[model samples]
Target: MVAQYPGMWSGRDDGATLWGKLAHDRFRYMAGIYKVHNWIDGGSGSGHNPLFAGRIEYNFLDPEPSPAYYTASTYYGKAHILAIGLAGQYQVNGVGSALQKGDYKAWNVDGLFEKRIGTKARYDVYTLEAAYYQYRTDGVCDIASSFNNHKADYGNIGGINSGTAILVSTAYLIPWRVGWGRIQPLLRYQQFRFAHHLYGPGNPKTRQFDAGANYVMDGHNLRFTFDFARYTPASGTQSDAFLLGMQMQY
Candidate 1:
């Protein structure tokens, strides 16, 4: 089981320090029809790899297109979440690392349906969703000398959680818009029962919360936002609390 050397490998900088998506809060909120997208491109200035060099990119386009390469666009029909987007990928040759898997062109789609409970009039703020797929592209099925490393969890079957589910979720949104801006709070409860080592044994269910304020400008159709989050799990393992960060949309 020894490869002679042990070191952590990295491909893309999707997120490391940030608190990540506050599923407790809607990443975006609007009543009417709209189109949206977001992108974040960053790299490490430190941590030179023991054998490989770190990344320096000219644009959001990286030599390794990993999970960080995502497109967020939504299409809603009568207060429902209908959007489809997938992250494609490009792998470096012979390395077994997706040094630049930019979104799978084979499975690539813009986004998919994201639905809430009711229509905009009633402001039904709760919803649940998931996506699954499986394909063989001649990629390695072994990692750490094991095919089990590819097992799926959360109701997905086989190497792809394509048919099974290990979890169910509940969501909530409380929002208000005033003359100055808009404010919203979000919450999510995730339940996982499938017994898999992917998330570890005795994997506890999860609960998360996010709160934010948006400065809405009608003239240019701009919304500037600041948010924070605190997560307490039904089965405590990785709980967190932090001032999330920021974003702007129109």
Candidate 2:
């Protein structure tokens, strides 16, 4: 077994194993395996429960060896790229419930389309990403716990609840040259929903809108971003927040 971090096996989890990607042009595929300790079903002597996951992605231009965890692009100038991906995961008696046999499953699919238009002095970059996720578990009680416990994409709501979610986001960038380097104006919109309404009457449904600007010095190596976001929840009050951040990469 292999892990991405040192001492990952020190916790309740035994170890993590990853299967590298096999790629051909625009297509890429990979898988992962891991196990968690089960103290109930006879402890370590009963063997650790297993978890499995796999992903497949296709990038239309400048292919990548594997799927990216995020759906954003920082490319400028003349370029066009579009990618689609599908991923799924399964866990056998994981995350606090040992009720019955293996009884949790999750699946998700997404697409990304990004493009840069015009020349150096005047260019526009835009990207759109959309995704959908489906979750199922053994019982209502298990589903309730999984929605709050299971950690995956789209917040803490994945892999074992009887709910559905869809997320869509779009971003646009306009860049201009400055004395120090380049300044980029970014605008983004996001919408997320739980179509099936897991908690019924008063569950949270989220929507967010953000606008930001970035200062790029050495590619993505050195950058500064300032943005404001307005968040609204269907079952709660609305809040507005702002952030100023610097990113440095060697």
Q: Report the CA-based lDDT of candidate 2 relative to the real structure.
A: 0.55
Model 1: weakest 10-residue lDDT segment is 34-43
lDDT of 1 by residue, 148-183 (tens): 342222211112111111222233343344666443
Per-residue CA lDDT of model 2 for 5-64, tens digit only, reads 111222123444454434545676666665542323422213344666677777787654
Backbone clashes in model 2: 0
Q: Given candidate 2, what's the lDDT at residue 115?
A: 77
Error of 1 at 183 (Å): 2.8
Q: Which stretches of candidate 1 lie over 4 Å from their true place?
A: 1-70, 73-80, 84-176, 188-239
Which whole-number lDDT from 0 to 100 does residue 47 have in model 1?
22
Predictions in order: lDDT: 0.28, 0.55
Candidate 1 lDDT for residue 126: 38
**Among all candidates shown, the one with the greatest lDDT:** 2
